[model samples]
Target chain A: EPEVTQTPSHQVTQMGQEVILRCVPISNHLYFYWYRQILGQKVEFLVSFYNNEISEKSEIFDDQFSVERPDGSNFTLKIRSTKLEDSAMYFCATRGQGRETQYFGPGTRLLVL
Target chain B: GESVGLHLPTLSVQEGDNSIINCAYSNSASDYFIWYKQESGKGPQFIIDIRSNMDKRQGQRVTVLLNKTVKHLSLQIAATQPGDSAVYFCAENIGTGGSYIPTFGRGTSLIVHP
Candidate 1:
């Protein structure tokens, strides 16, 4: 029953500030992903990471976003400049080798004012 | 340009009743599908999944039915309890090549009354 864990369950930041959301995926997972959901919208994919590199990213994952597995265990998503529209719930998901199921973390709620 | 969508926005059921949720996908290339439950303040939790090669799969008290021809998916919960109330979402993934990123649908809120 190992699950993904994220830090800073809730965060409120001012516009134009940089924010980094952290996640620690299951130890044996090989693929990691980031998704965001606006208050009343569907979950949107941001980016996917594997082998220390970005595998694929959506149009919303523009210049301001970057992901890193800096320590091999800590997967992080950083936003260079937060906008008011950036307010949403950011989720981290991981998939182990040979598995098609992606396990999700509790999520980090980000609010920009 | 792929999208997944739920047939209904909300469904209410009595405790101990069975509940069925439906989803439709616009992508014909999607080969893997998953159903997730999201309670308030929590992320989506995996409930069950089915591959394009299979038509049905069951887990615990849950069953997933997939129709490749019609591009439809449904999740069935037996003996639904009050704790089963949550927002459920269906996600589609194009498992072709090495890409496994999933596209999630708008969730359907399930309310179970005791």
Candidate 2:
């Protein structure tokens, strides 16, 4: 089964630095999303992307966050300035057209210090 | 519906036994639901789903039951194994006519003992 793929399985960055998390969804899927889970927390939606534009975003997805489909296969989330609270595991997901199932990637662990 | 805190409730079961995880959703408008299993170091994996119109749907070794009347949902695992030990979450979606995103439950940690 084809699955979503993410880069930098784990990352450590300094506070105030910029970080970008990357993902590659299943080749044929059309809807892509970014979600985050703080340690010992429920997974929360960050933003949903379709047709190169953001479909919806959560309140957590504030001014510091941005997402892009720079290429046919890559979806990325960038945080302009990191805060201590920004540390969490970020996951990417994709849902194909006509399919209700959304496949998730293993996730990228972001640690800010 | 109110957002829940991250302090997850947990359940323990022995290997080969059945395990049931329950959730009570507050939204009646939610017409779609999903169950996801997440490991210690991984993301949520899709397990099964049930539309509000259906009472039950079965996947490999897993069954999702929906009680729309009470806004309750449950996931039943048959012959549970150590591999089943993980945090399970219930997510609800109104779909908003294809406009709304899914709202996820706080999650429940399930531990299967050998």
Candidate 3:
């Protein structure tokens, strides 16, 4: 089974520092998404990307957050000026074209100190 | 916390027993629904999904039942094992024209004991 893979399984950064969480979606998947879950909270959608641009984003996806398909296989999420509340388990997911079964990665645990 | 389902519901079962986790969705327009499992320090793993058009779908050791009339969904795991101890979530969304931005339900913790 082709699965989504994320780099830097765990990251710790100081507040106000910038951080990039990297992910490589399934080789043939077309739609990519980013979601975060604070400890003991439900997973929340951050943004969705398709066709090399953002398709939609939630209110939590503010100016401090940005996503990019920097290459043919790499999708990245950059958080600028992180805050303590930014700490969460970030997940990257992808689905095939016209398919609703989205596969998720193992996630990167981001801790903003 | 005046946000959402502040406390997730929890279920405790013994090994070799069947586990049924239930969820009630708040959406009437949701056309697609999915069940995902999340272990202690990882992303959610897709377990199964059922469309509003269908009432039941079965997978390996797992079966999902959807009751659109009452807006309810349940996951039945057969012969639950200790490794099945994890949190399970039911998510719903209006799946039309290839959009999968789902509104997830508050997760339910399943503690399978030996």
Candidate 4:
């Protein structure tokens, strides 16, 4: 029953400000992912991380976004310059090796004003 | 672009009734599929999953049926309770021999009335 945990359940920031969202994945999980859900829209994949580097990223994951597993346990997503369109719910997910199922965290709601 | 999509936006059912949510996928390369439930403000929670090699899989009171020939998948919940009310999404993953990314559908909201 181990689950991924994210800090700052809700955050509000001004446009052009830098914001960092943190996530602590399951101890034994090997793959980590970040996804965002805009209000009334489908969940969109942002990036996937493995082996301490980015494995893949979507077009939406542009220069403004970056992910890091700095301490092997804390996975974080940083947005350098937030825009109004960046307001959405960011979710962190992780899956163990050889497992296809990804477990999602409660999510950190980010609102760029 | 290939995507996973739901057939309906919302479904209403009475308590104790059975509920069925449907999904469709446009990607033929997808080999893995999953069903997730998302309550109002939370992230998606894994409910059940079925591989392309299997046609049907059951878990607790839920059953997932996959029809690869028609690119269709459905989740059936037996004796649905009020607590079962949530937004359900079906996602498809295309394995690339390395890491796989999941494409999520718009989700179907299930409302169970007691």
Among all candidates shown, the one with the greatest TM-score: 4
Better of 1 and 3 by DockQ: 1
TM-score ranking, high to low: 4, 1, 2, 3
Best by DockQ: 1
Give model 1's DockQ, 2 decimals: 0.89
Scored by lDDT, the top model is 4
What pairs collide in candidate 3?
A: none
What is the DockQ score of candidate 3, to 2 decimals? 0.76
Q: lDDT per prediction?
A: 0.94, 0.88, 0.88, 0.95
Q: In model 2, state the lDDT of residue B18.
A: 95
RMSD to the true structure for each prediction, in A, is 0.9, 1.8, 2.3, 0.7
lDDT of candidate 1 over A44-101, digit per residue (tens): 9999998999999999999999999999899999999999999999999999987888
| Chain B TM-score of candidate number 2 | 0.91
**Docking quality tier of candidate 2?**
medium
**After superposition, which runs of candidate 4 have C-alpha atoms over 4 Å from their true positions?**
none
B-chain TM-score for every candidate: 0.96, 0.91, 0.89, 0.97
Candidate 4 per-residue lDDT over residues A1-113, each given as its tens digit:
79999998999999999999999999999999999999999999999999999999999999999999888889999999999999999999998998988999999999999
- B1-114 in candidate 2: lDDT tens per residue? 454222338999999999999988877777888888998898899899989889999999999998878778999999999999999999887554363466788899999999
Worst 10 residues of 3 chain A by lDDT: A95-104
Model 2 achieves a DockQ score of 0.69
lDDT of 2 by residue, A1-113 (tens): 89899998999999999999999999999998899999987788999888899988889999999999887779999999999999999999999886777889999999999
Worst 10 residues of 4 chain B by lDDT: B94-103
